[model samples]
Target chain A: MDKSTQGRLEAAVEALIFASDVPVAASRIVAVIGEVMAEPAPDADAITQAVESLNARYDAQGHVLRIRHWAGGYRMTTTAEMAPLLEVFLRRERRRKLTLPLMETLAILCYRQPASRPDVSHVRGVDADYALRKLLDIGLVDVVGRSEAVGRPLLYGTTQRFLEEFGLPDLDALPNLRGIEELLSDPSFSQEKARLFMLQGLSGATEAEQP
Target chain B: MYRVKLRDFDGPLDLLLFLIQREELDIFDIPIARITDEYLTHVRRMEAVDLDGVADFLLLAAYLISIKVRMLLPKPAPEASDQETEDPRLALVERLLEYRRYKEAAERLATIQELRAALYTRGSASAPARAEPQEVLINASVYHLIRALRRVLTEAPEAPALVIRARDCTVEQQQQFVIKALTVGRDLEFSRLIRGRNRIFVITTFLAILELIQRGLVVLVSTAFDDDFVLALGASGG
Candidate 1:
């Protein structure tokens, strides 16, 4: 495309992202830009290129704002460097942090989504009712469906709000869940277990007596 | 007394992990006797404090003691290879390992949440509005009220010599009592509502309060201090 056309496309994408309260999907941007420009719809690649050029310009000019791909869409967000000032302005310091139980419950649902209350309780060895309720209140979790197991308990899953809050572009963006074999293979794990075994053999009774 | 609060640990597994980590004991070869004794000590202290969810801890303690007993029993002659006789600790070990994996995942998520908190989005500046600054009353959940009830029960003086009386009290009666009490006073502390009442009365009143909350006849609110909750009239109640 000509320089003028490329410039207009970039401007349109930037405007859509900036004007949107929530993240704007690439397809949505392409359709709007195509309809407004009265031409064939631009492909996803062109939208991506426009976003890249916009980011490049922002970086070259040291702009505080940049477009971020989040929750499967593009959103305009201030750079991380501005967090402190933004925190003060937003009073985000007062924001409640998820408690340990809540975090654990959320992690379980995130990895083993559509899980029942009993399933989560079995893993944590504690009733998850409170944590699950709190998560539902926070809009991070929701009842996705009922399980097929006996009694057909309600199954919980993470919500789009969860993805946006965690800054995940999609569930696929989640960090790879470490497997049991991987965890067991760590040298430190084996070494620690061995050392403890030896210690137990040496002074089992005395160690048990210690406060 | 250094009371062990429920909030100090996430759950029974967390307490077990703490015990294992603190003693540097091998998760694979857990010193069952030692861990069981130590776990019982923690659970006793937790019970003494009357913390909510101590039942879960006690359940783990029982499991540990059972494992310790199995370890002490003489093993029957192996019909085949040594692997035929399964270790009593195997199930527990697998459980601990699985819980540990989730705990690690939780930590990783915390890191991600922290990093995500640092990045500001377009609407980040306009956070949800806070409650009126003059009085900060938090909306209390059933969990919070349960904790408060535990505290009240702990502080309650023991009942005098038991008298055989007719058990006429019902949840409906307690509900009426709560409604009447609320009518007399604009707001009522849960502890005060059940104060000096018999155990049966306290329990029935609690159930009644829960029912009231469910039916939109009552609401539980608390200040920054969470030791207790206040019951106020709900929209329907008003």
Candidate 2:
């Protein structure tokens, strides 16, 4: 990693991130740079440095777009100041919130995955087909594999996009699941504490999640 | 006419939760026969409105009815012990509790979705790169199309019942009509296509639009809910 080569690597990293519409992984960037330059692949640390340097440059230059690390990869996105304008330009409907049914289905999948549709339906006491299809269409939940249960139904799991979209670093970061026994112990749990907690939970989204 | 929009009907579990809250019923020990009657009453109202996606609710109603029937039946020899003979309501209660937990979590996720929607990305680069011809449409489902169809059908003037001959508009004929309409006037409004049409004509045209979408002849585009879709020439369209 000579001074000139280091500068070229940083430039290459920037160019790669800029060209990619999806997030670019550090390992993938290293492989591409190694293949293109016909040299040894740089380590992940080098790529991280390049990203940090690029961010610093963007900050110093007051550029609206910045390379963001999300879902274990880097992608270029505009600053929060630009979100309102970009949304207008994109003509995105902000009212496309996941309905309560869809959310309930997603929540079951999130905590109990990789679960079968039957499993989810059993717990929710309703047919999960429509909700599952909608979730699959939206790219939040995916058919991970077939379960080895009685009929070997398809197992569903949350995608990496789920983590990114939900502002969770990983499945481990999901809020702790309250014990069923604890909930069942209180007779008025569902109507009282659960309802209040859900209302309070609406404020779960945090500022750190902003791109 | 008590018209209910399809969006107004949440899942059956939601309706059950609402009924319990409204009736001020006990969660742990639900009065099955009473709740079933209330739930059926709600279902009857939805049926009157002719809601399309009420099958899920109907299925739950049937299940509740069965549970209510079981409650009427005598217990099996008092079972082995109280622990062995689990209360039937116990399972239903647990299911409701679990669903309630996830419903809350989903609301939390909804906040995240709103926040994520607020965060902006670079211009065209915000779009995901696709190896295949991506599902290049908004979150518009068949439900939206159906709702549009319902609205158009309802708005169309009532055809006289005494007509000697039925106005037969085949799907194939409607397909040709749609293509011709789009070719002559690109990006035509969906409502305009079905406006002033009879019930049969409106249905056939809706089917034709779906076929055109399938064949990549035209694409449906809308930026807002309940907004009329524009039928524009697709990539493969002439």
Candidate 3:
């Protein structure tokens, strides 16, 4: 490709990503450019290179926003440094933090997709009805389908926004589950695990308080 | 008796795990009889506080008692001798282990969520518009109803049941009272409606509000969280 064509492709990629209200997949970018240019679409590699150059250009220009690769696509977002400014401009309130109960319930559903409400409640050792309802309301979880297990309760799974909000590219990006097993087998399991469970805001004397 | 706050007890499994860790007991070989005794003691404390959701803890307590009984009775040896007899605590231990794993996972995910909080995105304004309507209408509507009732109940005078008297007002009568109260031109504050009333009257008034809401006789407008809701007569009610 000539230098002019390469520059045009780079500009096209930047423009396409900027104009998109949602994340623009590489293939979608290629398809749009191909249809408009009335020529063969650039390969995924070329598009990726174009995006990389576009980002470099943005960095050199000290642009406040840059393209972010999230959930298998690219979208434009302001720098993390600009968060406070943007928040003030938007008059945004502090988003509600997930309560410990909701986080526990979400983790169970995340690791155990297609799990029923009873399955989740049994694991958490609490009735997850309210937590599940809140998660559904917040769009972090959805009733993916009904389980084949007895009673055929509705199966819940993490939604796409869960990945997007968590900055995960996909479910595969989740931390290794084996970490928990390793932590459990450690000699100082109780202390370390209790400290990790700061979700409840109780750090010390957790064991001493038990009957 | 050591009193565990209701909020501190995450659930039965959380309490049970705490007990096991505190005693340094093996999960695989729980001392069923002793743990059951300790667990029931904790349940007694929980009952003292009148915890709202003790059903799951009670269920676990019952299971622990059953396991203790099974341990007391001699079990028949397996005929094949190939498989060791299943421990009665096996199911409970498995569940505890599973729950512990997920709790750890939740901790890990919380860290990730914290990191993600640093990353801001566009469309916060439009996002809630799409997601809020259904949840706000169905869930928040009922939640606000309960909250409003609680607020009004606080203003109500303490229950004076010591002075025995015949029931003066029925739910239907209270419903009529609400209708008459809101029949005036302006909307009424929930706290105002129940203020200075006795407990029975306050409860009946709340029930009346619920009944009116159910029959579309009144509309509840809560301008902000935990604020007194304005009860307006619905068009149908008018």
Best by DockQ: 1
- List, residue by residue over B77-180, the lDDT tens digit for candidate 3: 77846344556766676577667877888898998886776566666545542423221112232245456768988896887869976677889999999999
The sequence of per-residue lDDT tens digits that candidate 1 reaches over residues A1-211 is 8888888889999999998888889999988877878766789999999999999999999999889888889989888898888878876554456767889999988988889999999899999997898789778999999999999999999998898888899988888667655566567477666445335332343243222
lDDT of each: 0.81, 0.75, 0.76
lDDT, residue A138, candidate 1: 79
Estimated TM-score per prediction? 0.70, 0.60, 0.65
Give DockQ: model 1.
0.32
Interface RMSD of each: 4.4, 5.8, 6.2
Candidate 3: TM-score of chain A is 0.81
Q: Candidate 3 - CAPRI tier?
A: acceptable
- Clashing residue pairs found in predicted model 2: none
Stretches of candidate 1 off by over 4 Å are A192-211, B1-7, B80-84, B127-238
Q: Rank the candidates by TM-score, best first.
A: 1, 3, 2
Task: Name the better of 1 and 2 by TM-score.
Answer: 1
TM-score quality measure for candidate 2: 0.60
Clashing residue pairs for model 1: none
